[model samples]
Target: MTEKVLIIDDDTNLLSGIQRQFRNKFDISVAEGGEKALDMVRSEGPFAVVICDMRMPGMHGVEVLGSLKEHAPDTVRMMLTGNADQLTAIEAINEGNIFRFFTKPCPSDVLAKGIEAGLEQYRLVTAEKELLRKTLAGSVMVLTDVLSMIDTDIFGKSTRLRDWARLLAGHLKLPQPWILDLSVMLSRIGWVAIPAEVREKFKSGESLSKKENEMIQRIPETGKKWISHIPRLEPVAEIVFYQNKGFDGSGFPDDEIAGKDIPLESRVLKVLNDLAGISQDTAPTKLDFRQLDLQAQLYDPEIVQIVRQSLPKADAENRDLYFETAEVPLNLLIAGYELLSDIETKDGKLILAKHQQLTKTLLTKLRNIGEIQGIKEPIRVRKHIVRKV
Candidate 1:
């Protein structure tokens, strides 16, 4: 756990000076130009602080800092330049998100303190992010494991779907944790509502009758019922309900949600589910599920392309963790909500519905901030069908 400091400057004298100044206090790596510096930062990091020169031949310090921010954002950036021009400093601060600006005549003590503080901040921020990632990963494992018992087939599908969902999320450049892990895990809960015969038929490429299609439509409702009761899953439940939705407003149950109005998670999941269908089915390779999904009105064209590009990469990392750990729990249906206590045991119906709505809102806000991927539409829960009393 040694703290690493990266010094990038065209001036070998200044680079050596800084390296020697901090030699006793920190571990240092030096580079003469921006390109070489960038390569170092990208490959051998977790760098604690990056000290860069503003004036250089190949790439200026500000430009180098910008690239560093993109490649290793958590690394603290400092600009060291001879020029004290206020406008240049302001621009660097705004564009490159520079942490500290040091002039050429900076005192050794002051520069040392700046580097130390920057490294401290980097350590804190990276530690927080690593903790968050671990937390999210742990929660995902628990939830996916539980889901495996809920439905073995769905567990396998969910694991595969999550692998693909992660790829789609990255392809779309989404940052939401729950959307990537939870949405894909819960996407197949709707299948729990479909009869084994219908699911087998759907998987086997058998076309269903109109009545069968309508029955299949109720799967979302079934998903909602189960999802609403799980407090931890409330946020991504809409994806479970609407992964089959159309981007052009042609998906099942509620069709009014279209384009950006649809949750991003839903849009991402739509592509994931469609691709999973293509992979699991006997469709010929290069059948272009994205084209078929968009043309058939199951997914948006934009979303389809995003999925298409990421599919190759996702396939490379598809571990099928969810599917392998998932199992058909004994008395799965009868043991609903045993793991969750925040949900109502007294007012089961009303509270569950309310919980469903709250989770949808939370997820919607998270998506708007560009934190998650999937649907671009908000899925409205359909009212229960009323038969003649």
Candidate 2:
């Protein structure tokens, strides 16, 4: 495949000459000035290399290439200028992260060689990024899948927490929401360390002894330990470490960090985790918002307000529909549906509670429960109707 090259020069004649020289060797694009170059970079970019003339009207080549570093870092950058002073070269390299620096009267062969090098750099950078992305994705999938197999209950909780976190993050227009989503999914990973009996007892809402409570408090730390070893998961580990932190610095792993000192992602997770707990009681009510507010410093006030304002609209968007257990397709049991009543085993042990969102994991667990312990027929669920805008 041919690599694309962009050449930006204020001198129209020079631009035309460069394009004509390289057009046959590569897919060449020409831009008359820095502004036009930037526009092309943004709109028709992912170019293998960009060659810019240093002196231009309105944004200089240094500034243009710097913007490209932010907008398209994988695109290799080169600067051409008649002024080849040491300071100019240093500034170009430092600010624009230029891969190559050439004088205005550079020979065609030298420029071509530079473009070849730049293309190679672009390929290497993009390939590394793609590899990192796939590795991270696969690692997360394996961990979450294992968590799901080990304990569906915890997996179900993570799914709900992720849903709430995603919704709240989207509301706030938080950047890189996938990080928050992944953090929430693995937030309960520490539970794997707890003994099965203790885990079950905790899930059942039974009173825990002092030792048991202490063990529970250490869960986040355990999660941090588990995740810290994974490459590129440093931020995720920190968020998991502080997931139980309070707005007032009152929660576990008691530290001086409080208020905005806590990572924004951690604070968001804390709010969503608490909200998920509240929501499990049934769909949250106005009173529930009041209760959350009354908790005093447990959550960020701004986030709490956002949640309060969002709930009514969320509720309005969802209308209730019912379906029998056998008739309900697995795909239909989507996120945000509430259970009208307890889904219980034949022995009357509650499997899933009323008003809990019917996540895919939960639905699979429900089906497994039906196959294993057996459930009563005509299982009823309150499906949330998403109204068309």
Runs of candidate 1 with Cα error greater than 4 angstroms are: 156-207, 211-389
User: What value does the lDDT take at residue 307 in candidate 2?
Assistant: 71
lDDT of 1 at 92: 90
Predicted candidate 2 versus true structure: per-residue lDDT over 1-389, tens digit per residue:
46789998889898888878877788999998888888897678668899998888899989999998888778899999998999999999999999899997999999889988988988898788778877776677567755765665666566556656666776877645667877887788899899989988998999999999999999999999988988878889999999999999998878899999998888888877777676644335676676777785889989878777664332423433322222344335565565656667788976765544565556677788778888754555655344466
Local accuracy of candidate 1 as per-residue lDDT tens digits, 1-389:
38899988898898888778778888989999999998887568768899888889989888899888887888899988898699889979997899999998889999889988998899899788777767766765666555454444445456556656665665676645555576676666666667778876875679998988888877776776787786556667776677667777776757677777777888777776666555632121346563464465656678766665656532312323211212222122121111111122222311121102122223233244332232222222212223455
**Steric clashes per prediction:** 21, 0
The most accurate candidate by lDDT is 2
Q: Kindly report which residue stretches of model 2 are placed more than 4 angstroms away from their true locations once superposed.
A: 1-80, 102-131, 149-151, 170-175, 281-285, 309-343, 349-372, 381-389
Q: Pick the candidate with the highest TM-score.
A: 2
What lDDT does the true structure give each of the candidates? 0.65, 0.78
